[model samples]
Target: MSDRQRSDTVHYDGPAGGWGSLRGITRIFGKEWNSPAVLETLARQNKPGGFMCTSCAWTKPANHNPLEFCENGAKATLWELTTRRCTPEFFGKHTVTEMLDWTDYDLEQQGRLTHPLRYDHATDRYVPCSWDEAFAAIGRELKALHPDEAVFYSSGRASLETAYLYALFARLYGTNNLPDSSNMCHETTSVALKKVIGAPVGTCVFDDFSHCDAIFFFGQNTGSNSPRFLHPLQEAVKRGCKIVTFNPVREKGLIAMVNPQSPTEMLTGQETQISCAYLQVKPGGDIAALMGLCKHVLEKDDEAKLEDRSVLDRTFIAEHTTGFAAFEQKVRDTSWDEIEQNSGLTRRALKDAGQVYVEAERTIGIYGMGLTQQVHGFENVAMFVNLLLMKGNIGREGTGISPVRGHSNVQGQRTVGIAEKPELVPLDKLAQMYGFEPPRNKGLNTVDACEGILAGKVKAFIGLGGNFVRAIPEKEAMEEAWRRMRLTVQIATKLNRSHLINGEVAYLLPCLGRSEEDLQASGPQTVTMEDSLSCVHGSIGKRSPASEHLLSELAIVAGMAKATLPPNPNVTWDEWVGDYGKVRDRIEETYPDQFAQFNERMFTPGGFYRGNSARDRVWKTESGKAEFTAPKHLSATGFADAPGRYRLITLRSNDQFNTTVYGYSDRLRGIEGTRNVLLINPDEIKRMGLESGQMVGLETDAEDGRTRRIYGLAVTPFDLPDGAVAGYYPELNVLVPLSHHDVQSKTPASKAVPVRILV
Candidate 1:
């Protein structure tokens, strides 16, 4: 049978309260108590002096109960603590070709790697290699290449210390090719926030959700993407806060949620309403919807401001902002007809949303990749900033902009200077602190790195935790480039797609997972991580190492540094590797303000938080105050001349997390045993004369005449708006060309692609 037929062998979508819910309940209870892995993982969750949850970026209260983990968090924990092991003997029996043929789920589920393995081209198999030999080979190859030819990639799962050290090593080696996971997801948010607010971080904290009178949620699926966010949403609803959601699909959690935390609600099976108003906006139409709301508010402010203090903060705007007059003029000049046609929303609906914001005393706006992964993503965010500034919602108790970052430490990695284009001031500071002139040349981001590889300008690649190939867009081009590199080094816990696509010399170096203890020469060492909320905390693993031969990410970096960099009299790379405290000392010396008390703070339960823009209201703009930005006339995703094509938005299943597939089922979406289904509106399917559950092919409508297609997909009728559809990511990333990326951020517009469906 074909893969699609095998996937469809099982299908069941009964009521969630029956055996389905019982299975889920059994999985949760059984995994926690009966399974040894679950018990060990639960011990780490929210424990005092332990690491922050590595699953999601949500931050909890400083002193929460010991079991403050979410459902996905439990999944991640169990996955890490699995008993299966992929040892060198296992690799000895399987060839790279054979391994590549296996599905991603099977490849990862084979288990954690036990030792470093080097791929042999002659045998087409990977063989075990000692740490010393692997380091020497990598160093030799890297030293042979010019600094510009080497690329370093970091994942969001990497600890702050590992990322900082990796940056230092890359700079020391004289290269800035640091393409990271951020480049693929939220690079647009960072780029836009910096231009408008002078800071790339969000301006809201967990506490801000409690105080907000209303929140405008755009393109964010809180239930699956960040389940921990549901608790706060529940609390906000209890406090009578209005939630307005705008998305292509109606997410279940956004409309009504059964709070598992509430004993009364849980026992009675009661559900609480979440979104006061849910608008089904077309895919890639976020800019138009947002602009329409801004226009509505500006046009009616004169009459509406009579009773609503939230309509406009005249005092704050006059003192702390500029460019409002220009922004207001642009909103006034914008026509409602254009907004309605582009946003696919009626003028009345837009006005109703505007009125909510106008009446609420305090309001916050939260967005996700749906808004960020677009050609005009940067401008889309700037438009939101304009709206917030117009209403003076920023730097207040209950109002601000919150960009829901995906990775656990994505924000933190950027915080400690992990940028391809490091500012001159930070470079100068590092030079002064480390006694060496830092490289001033700009570095390569994800897109730039891929270009370099394809052009043969990049020779070496180093990945610090992540499946680089699958995580990036333009998979075919990226895979081809990976094969052309002189050397590829992966510091990961398990085998991934990146490991299969090798270069002349490729090494898969197994490392300690987040749940495993890290022992250096000095003894057990602990690392620190920063959550989305800007809170820094210590993470010390209690579980034994997955393999005795596996090394910590820090050690691997140090080993590579020893082999690659020339003897530097100022920096003691050996000493830092010997004792993790020495690394902390270096961090303190480098970024004293951020890493002060790095050694002593770990002992404190729940490590200290860093400085945040929301707490102090310190606008770091050129004018020393927040500024209103004018909206540029641009569509969210640029339209192609696809006469009969619809824009398709790609998302993740509830069982998947950034290329790591836990299972093939998406329980909440009623999908079972398959990830190859296309979600379409019933009207659109009927218009096209396509039946639900029929196999269909999707082709991209690109100007280059490139035929990007995914065939044999079952169509599931959903409540999607016309001209919009949904599919899984990475699978659909093939349709998104590398050239079709956000202009300012270079982030692939994966969430917005024009395609034609055929049965």
Candidate 2:
């Protein structure tokens, strides 16, 4: 049956967490892993001595409760600890062509991959292959092409040791095409922050959550993305902290939440209200909304000056910041009519929200992909820094910017040198340590890599983890282009669509998951990961490997490096694989400033903080001061509105993490059974003369002349803005044009696509 036939929707007015979350956790555990290993896994999650939670990058608190895992964290743990396995026998029964017809959820539910397999073009199937044979074949394929022709991709799931080795391997091979998960999610934050605050990562650590008196959330849904963060929000609320949110949809997490760990709250069905003010701004309207807040604050600062009261931190501005005059002029020049029209918020509402910022002595600004995945994503983030700068809400305790990272170690991967730009990494240090001059030319990013593949410029692809073909925009085009590549290798724990889309020479290398023990020749090895807050902690797998044939990611990467390169006397790939500590030591030599005493500090009780210079009022910018950016216009997205077009925002359901679909339910949004649905505002539905459950189709208003469309989707009314619509990602990724992205960062504008409904 088709997805539309089985799909249905319901009205869910209940709070985000309560019994609903408990039931979801119970269902996943019973479905995937009903063994005592689940409990053991939960106990180890987010602990310094245990495995980092693979669900999200939210950090663990220093003083934590015994049961620190959230409902989604439990689900992610169970998912990795499933009993089911995808063996060679399973692959023999189904050909690659046949599996292409399966759903993403069905493909993943087949469980963890247990053996290495090589694709056979004649049989159109994957067959069992020895490690030596696969390695030799991949080496042959890679050696046939220039180093520049190969694109090395790493997922956010990879540990620091694995990622460090992966980056070194690529640089040794004389190429810098290292595109990763951040390319699509938070590259805008990295690019924008590097120019504004001279740091590419968030300034707030987990401890900052407790000392802040107020927080402003922009385009962030803490419940669905990082459920573990709700605990801090719950405590902050109890302490009477003011939380304000500006998003297109009134996210359930921002509205109210019930802590599943609390017996009194869970048993009594009590919920804590999360946000004091939730402003439902229009889709892609975050820039205008942020500007409106800044305008109100600027005007308030003027009034405060008259009364001899301190509103703006004029002292901090004069001593540590630059371009304030131009930034202030831009804010004052922006009329309220433009701000209200673009932001879909009233002057009164924005002023009230600004008043909260004005009153709070210390405040934290938090955001997610909603603000970073737009046409003006870079400007959107820079504007937020501007707002915080005006109030001097940075470089001090309890005051900074927090970007909620989606992947567990995406930030870590970037820190360890998974970047396309050569200037981002320390090439001189790498050359001195590795005895090789690294390539200096800028390499292909995610979008650039896709374009290169389609143009026959990039011939080989190696993925450390993740479903690249499925996660990126222009899915169909990427799939077709991927097939033409000379070689493709995926090092993963589970099966996904990217594996089925085989190239001329494809190898599926099964690797141990983070929760599985990596017993190397030396002994049981431990890998470390950096969380969203920049804490680098150790992760020791608690469970045994799913199969004896499975290898650690470090081993696989080292094997490829050994086979691909003709004996390099300078690098010892085998030694690093035998004991991961050797890898950490080399990492220390390369980045002594940050990774000093790397092995010793990584396993510390709460892990060591990778200090942020911005937090200490030290600016690394060229001007030696924090820079303020003023955009040329107030539009968040450059797209002009049309009669039948609506701003489309793609999001994730609670059941999915990134492109990995776990089930067919979005419990928080009241969607179940299928993902083939579109959420529209009730007013928009009425104005369009459409019914609530009307089956409809959508076509992109991209004007690219490529007919991007989806069919047989049910239109469900939701509490979204009138001119906006929302749908699940990956499925809706087709509507996202390849060329539509943030011009500065080159990150895809997944959150903002313009489409028209066809009844």
- For model 1, the superposed segments whose C-alpha errors exceed 4 Å read 1-37, 304-310, 603-607
In candidate 2, what are the lDDT values of residues 83-131, reduced to their tens digit?
A: 8999999988999999999989999899989999999999988899999
Candidate 1 local distance difference test against the native:
0.79
| True-structure RMSD, every candidate | 4.2, 3.3
The CA lDDT at 741 in model 2 is 91
lDDT of 2 at 600: 86
What Cα-based lDDT does every candidate model obtain? 0.79, 0.88
Worst window of 10 by summed lDDT in candidate 1: 1-10
After superposition, the stretches of candidate 2 with alpha carbons farther than 4 Å from their true spots are 1-11
User: Cα lDDT for residue 495, model 2?
Assistant: 90
